[model samples]
Target: MNDPSGPDRPPAARPRVRSDLDGLPLFRGRAAQSGMIRLDCNESPLAPPAAVQAALTGAVQGLNRYPDNAAADLTARLAERHGVPPAALSLGPGSVGLCAQLIQIACAAGDEVLIPWRSFEVYPSLAGTAGAVVRRVPLTAGHALDLPAMAAAITDRTRLVFVCSPNNPTGTSVSRADVERFLAAVPPDVLVVLDEAYAEFTGRQADPLDGFALVREQLRQGRTNVVALRTFSKAYGLAGLRIGYCLSAPPVAELLGRVAVPYAVGTLAQRAAAAALECEPEVRERCRHLVEERERVRAALLDSGWDVPVSGANFLWLPAGPAAEPLAAHCREQRILVKAFVGEGVRVTVGTAAENDAFLAAASRFARTEAAAPVRSAALG
Candidate 1:
């Protein structure tokens, strides 16, 4: 049945690629600094270690050939380092990609995902792009994960819940007890994702439910919804390699592996990641320095009259809220660049001790000026 205007019929409305992405750079909101005291992105300040550098020198010979489609060596290294089976892991360009894949596995169009307000900003956006409705739960006064409210927000539509421990921009986490209670309250079919990118920096020996342990625990309890994610980008200083992973039940792992882009972790990344896994001493020392600097920097800021939480990650969170833009601008002018959230707060990654000193100095000046302005206004009144 050919219609008169069949050839001229309007093309069907094409859905834009992935719903929300408009060919925009994902990290567009974060300010960039070509060279400055960079405290914005939570990236390691140092270059790759000598061992990693040597490995890269060796890996250059293979760039011409296709990378390992399976990223087999890195997967085995990840499993061995974390004490999980290689079959339980799925790799990606970064944890963000892994999160996207997890959302794909867990949610159907219009299904809902739960994300925390003061946590990683990408959560809601990624979930939305995956055809899921994003459910945002605000943080508690202490800036910690609000488990009770999050649990209440859960409805039949909910499918995935992302828990970013030492949560980005906020720097707090759910306690072990809280995690257990939250798990108990959540339904079995719903996927719970625990992102532990900052886990290595924590000084404490026991983290209530280590994501690695949760995978095995969930299995022992006949559950299939828990997943733990980690990355070598932070402590290992491999941010440029774009390698990260999620651990799940073997079935879920299989699904994630199938959905992820083949060879997402390039051959170089695989080799470097494998080598990094064995350099525990180096990684641990760097993290220790970060933790120490986090304390020193936080103390310096507080002593100089800045309200901030003691961080468990490699960064500090300042409730700059309305002060964010100005503070960031001020820091940039002083040759330092720190993280800022429009109406939320600011996050400052711990750089080298000297770099941290420079940032603190800039902040002190900002705080002093702010302090004197009110007094001067009062005098005029």
Candidate 2:
């Protein structure tokens, strides 16, 4: 009975601004296509050792019972491994969740969190969703972190700074000296989160920044402003379990736990993670294998005169640029799924020995095509 031209109803209220999402595909799932080599995500190519399997079987006995809410025992073992007190650690579903939680606790609308461009895709997205302004800095010319520029980017509004050592996608790392300089430059008020998810593969015996040691020193200085985020997912080969831990001051640890979902570190996850921790020898050996393969893959690419960057993570970063899409397409056509950077190039994870061989074949073919193109003429002319 009412007029058809009557004023339209107002739209329903929605979240005004999602943290750094800015229309980015933060949760895009991988496509399920046949012949997929599956090197998209940075997961360990190896499976958890047999001891871990047995431990998981034991936990199945308690499937009906709830997990240890405190995660105290696991946290204790983690603390001992790092030589810190149990009160200084907190576990999470994974290191990624802890990153999200840290932002939620410290960041508010208009506040800024500093991160790197061409690094972990999650940082900006998480910061944006947590209501913080994301300040994205470009990596240095060599693909390493631009610590100086990052320090310069910090302002009074900056609350958190995330440094992904052996950065994702690019596989470059900031040196210990650079990190020390960066820390010295940033204001003491800003909290620094050193994400060491791939640290185990770096092969640096006295780990740069020695995040564990740094956390302890920072806390002793009455600084509640530093944290080292590590995971059992990568080196421990338990990515499916999704267990990670943080080393920070107790107050900060407690704050993170408060913001964390109750029982997020699941029963199975905790037990499996604990079991994995006990097998340092096996875990270390696997990491050593990955490091070895990373070199083998890099050598083959370099011998072909491919302009591959020096990478330390369980992946390699290639220079695709204009050919990026086409190169990725070529690999995809052959049923190999690698992580493609629309803005940069392709990131190929160092998969199992067999998978690496397949990727190398694809890459070599692409390189030959590139070599035969007008690119040579343009460069010479």
Candidate 3:
């Protein structure tokens, strides 16, 4: 008999992958390039506070042991900070990770997740990964979430809805009153996830929605569907640590914890995040400065005749339409990186003063060059 392990032996069949994932777009972070000023990923321009850095250094000694699976200490700190019971909070690697858990807990194959188009790109990917049908509600003419349309789009099949305030790419936020009205239209059984990753930067915006406050009220009223997600990556400068938390009704939080990967939030991240909470004053100051920089950059772009929308987040949206890719290309050529959304627009993160100035100069040059050229159709044909 021929040996089964012989070189000419028949190859074994490859393991099967989920057919639904074939067309799914993978999310990739922009790689850092030496000498390139990156204003593409919406990251904090500053370093983490000294206290947080110190905490990380101290945490390194405990690497031989496993992280606290429950994240007890950090959870308690967050509970006190938000004035909520520890039972109502769940910690994950990041708000994005929490988002995936949220989808897992709420959706099964063929269930629907309602999201605004061009808001957070991850929402669709996460929902799709769970085999959930994604219903994209288009943004309004002003590049903002159309709450009325989204409310109408919900059906009995809808399992979850993601409301991204000061939305990711557009930087347009809905008012608290607007969210309250939208909530009234949504069925209580369907989960509404308030993604507030940039909540710390919304202090300067008019009528900003306090997601935690809203969730607290909902919990008090015995409603358990509304959940608030906050991340330490943006204003807290903990992007590298990958720590975030969510506030929801105790039952929802319990579900999230149950579905979370074992020890998802590592010891270093937990310690760093807890230390970050103690440095709230420093975090607030950094956010204040970034918000100011955001406004200044928007003003400059507006003066250059760019249809820049008012931004409440740490970035600005340039609704360049068909010019989006070319504009991003031009900035890239100047050794500056900005995010371009194919036919939609470009999102430029606010950076240090010098870096912002460099980006501004490149943008001005691109504007002048485009002006000197013949006008192209919006279709780019």
Candidate 4:
């Protein structure tokens, strides 16, 4: 008899995966390499406040039990804090996870998800994973989202639109008035997701868009298609814990909850976020310092002849054009890391003053070297 388990037997057919996913671009946030001054990911340079740390310590004792799938206590606390009913909130691993769920609930196959080009990299990936067509509207010449262009691009099949305030990698935002005007032009059936991952850093910016306030206004107006995503990752120093909440109409929030990964928000994350809310003064102070640093860094880059845009976030975008990768490599040589978008630009987070100073030093040196190369080439010619 033939040996059924022998090497001669045909290899078991590989499990099938969605072939469309093969075309999806891998998400690419660099991890902190050893001994590098990491400013690549837009994570808070400071750790969580003492109260939050204590909460995490206490929460560790209950790891044997599954987290509350509904995150009831945390939801109630967040509802009270935001002055929204608990029914209007949905918890997820991060705002990014909520983003995926938003795409899931809104899009069927071939439906469209509109986003600003180069806004958040994950938007396309999430939409594509849900079998939706990704539509990108380009940013304006000044690197801000072109809200009018995005509004014009929407078709009836457009199920969701992501408006990332203080857009990732660019550090530019849409003003409240501009967003309101754009919303007026949007079809009432299309969902608008205001991604406010860096909202705390925008307090000092002139005429900043308050996403939570906008969501509340939409709800009061009986529009159920607008949603706001907030995270504890940035200003609250809970990036590792991965807790975020969505503010939406009660029906939308319920839909998000229905599709969310059960218990994705852990016990420690919930407790830590609750403790973080109690330490609002400390979080505010930290954000204040980061904003100041962000402005200072932008000024320094401008003074050094780099055309840095005015940012409402805790990072600066250096539109390095073709030299983006080389500039990033130069910083790495000095043991500093920044997120580079290849031919597009580089995003450097506002870290502690010393860290910023070191990056500034590296950046200055790279600028001088870059400036000299063309001159030398001209002389050679």
Question: Would you list the clashing residue pairs of candidate 4?
Answer: none
Model 4 lDDT tens row, 114-160: 99988888898999999999999999989999999999999989999
What is the per-residue lDDT of model 1 for residues 299-358, given as tens digits with 9 covering 90 to 100? 887776567875678888987666777788889898888877886678899999899989
Between the candidate structures 1 and 4, which one is better when assessed by TM-score? 4
lDDT of 2 by residue, 109-150 (tens): 889999988788888878878778888999987787888899
The candidate, 1 or 3, that scores higher on lDDT is 3
Model 1 clash pairs?
Answer: none
lDDT of each: 0.82, 0.83, 0.90, 0.90
Candidate 3, residues 191-214, lDDT tens digits: the string is 999999988888665677999999
**RMSD to native, candidate 4:** 2.9
Where in model 3 is the C-alpha error above 4 Å?
A: 1-12, 371-381
Candidates 1 and 2, the one with greater lDDT: 2
Taking all chains together, the TM-score of candidate 3 against the true structure is 0.95
**Counted clashes in each candidate structure:** 0, 3, 0, 0
Tell me the deviation in Å of residue 234 in model 4: 0.5
Q: Residue 163 of candidate 4: its Cα lDDT?
A: 97
lDDT of 4: 0.90
